[model samples]
Target chain A: MTPIDEDPPPPSPAESLRMIAEQREAAERQLSPDPLVYHGPWGVAWLVGFGVMFLRHGPGGTVLVAMPAWLPLAVLFTLLIGAAIVSGVLAGRTSRHVRGRSSVQGAMYGFSWFVSFAGMGLTLQRFDDGLSPPNVGLLWATVAVGLTGALHMAGGAVWQDRLLFGLGVWLTLVNVVGTALGPGWHSLVISLAGGAVMLLLGLVLRRRPAGRPNE
Target chain B: MSELDPVIHAQARLRVVAALSALPEGDQLAFPRLQEILGMTAGNLSVHLRKLEDAGYVEVTKTFSGRTPTTLVCLSRRGRLAFEEYTAAVRALLPPPST
Candidate 1:
């Protein structure tokens, strides 16, 4: 058989592992404290809040704790918890995909978030003239923030759920819209709605898949 | 065609395939950007990449990003054809659903 007819042998386990390591390293090199890490955390924070809603709603009424009258604080706490959980889950899943696949997984990881974040941008601009004109300046500022978050989420995709990147983007966009929409209390609606969407998205990710194992 | 053939297929490498497959002809990825996307150890990735290089599936080029060394990966024509063939073969193997 001609050399052209012969297919290249598939990559070895060691080689596959090596590629993942390299991509992870490259991600780290590009990360910066100013944006990638910070916005990343912010995006994760919202995802966790979305996740918690599932826990709260899935289980029947446990004793509800009524604390002080600080609405902002309440939202903050929920957001924190939700982001943490979502971030953790996403990280684990992305990591698993990366370890089993190749750098293309990383790109898939990045592309997903980019699309979600971009979608959020489009959604927000369309709804700008709502009850509260999203702090126009702040909303614009958050774009940079979202990009940073995208980078961070993608970084996590290095070893976490490749799909988590999409979750991160959606969460970040929803929060950005929520923040622009109005006071925290009102924003709760956005969080709840976003959570529902994320749950569906997660299920979808669990279903449809990327093609070809990295060789 | 080998069905269920086990080779070095790992997460990062698979990621590379997915990324390349998505692009128009000749679109490439820089090493650092890819690293951020995959989140693996550098030493580990480089070794696998070298194997891809040797295999003629991926082409790597060294250039200067400022003064730093940057490696870019792109799907070689051969690699693209192989992937296309592999995908077609996989699709052919899928069981048809009952009406």
Candidate 2:
């Protein structure tokens, strides 16, 4: 018969506490939210949604000759909403697998978008009679950019993530440029430039190895 | 002696509680995942987990994700409160910080 191995001596109380402290530190590092998980999908959604809106409303003011202006807006709304739902589900599932903290943070982030967009819609309705179609579109674009920028910045600050913070600053600048240049230029920048940036970010995030810290 | 929780005083159990406490409320870690993180053998981990379960510090769920059976462990509200109390007691017992 094989002899049984003897158990090792238990650690001293002080040693055990110290081991716990070390483990805690390691766990904290492991538990922090990975940017790619949330940001990748988020960026893609905005990119596609905004890109479609830009094509319809840019300087030329109608890419599809047969389609009505309202159709473009409708499409944009559908795409954004669809993206949000899909991304939310994906984030939830991924968090479950990884035991990640980003699920709550991502939900809060989505809430910010809902509030911003809904507020803009309500404000527009209040001044519906006074505002021109172009003016309304511009207001929509500006609000979207502003809110997105602010939310990203807030996320960056909360998470201490430089990439998110940088993206926020860039998006804020895009808003400034869009507001200054008018709706056509604004749409062009957001669709082409902003979309590209977001898409690039998504791809980069997708490629990043799991369990790696953003820092 | 007065500061530490008797249930949480042991090294393995303390590690288990600490790991669970780090997770968000309602989140559970699979037994294998917890074992990997805590660097313990399956049998050892199970024994410690059973101890925690008996103490009302953690709740374990046996569920299948597809065909494979999984044991997921989560800290209960009681467990969280106890951990908090234990930490506070430990802190109170510590010496004042030096300038």
**Local accuracy of candidate 2 as per-residue lDDT tens digits, A1-215:** 12112322124544655665667655554555444545555566566666666666666565734446677677667866766777666646545544324556666776777787788777767765678877778887787788888888897776667777889899999889878888767876776566668768766865654332332
Best by lDDT: 2
lDDT string, candidate 1, A30-133, tens digits: 32112223234454444454233323322232213443334433565676555545554555443332221343555575467657667766876764665343
Candidate 2: true interface contacts recovered: 0.16
TM-score of each: 0.35, 0.59
Window of ten residues with lowest summed lDDT in model 1 chain A: A29-38
Under CAPRI classification, how is model 1 graded?
A: incorrect
Q: Can you tell me the DockQ of model 2? A: 0.15
State how far residue A209 of model 2 sits from its true place (Å): 2.6
What tens digits encode model 1's per-residue C-alpha lDDT throughout B1-99?
455322223344555654544433444666655655666578766766676667787777877667977777677887777666655554555557669
Q: For each candidate, what is the lDDT?
A: 0.49, 0.69
Stretches of model 2 off by over 4 angstroms after superposition:
A1-37, A60-66, A94-110, A211-215, B1-44, B48-99
**Candidate 1: where is the Cα deviation over 4 Å?**
A2-68, A71-74, A77-188, A203-215, B1-57, B86-99
All DockQ scores: 0.12, 0.15
What TM-score quantifies how close candidate 1 is to the native fold? Answer: 0.35
Clashes of each: 49, 0
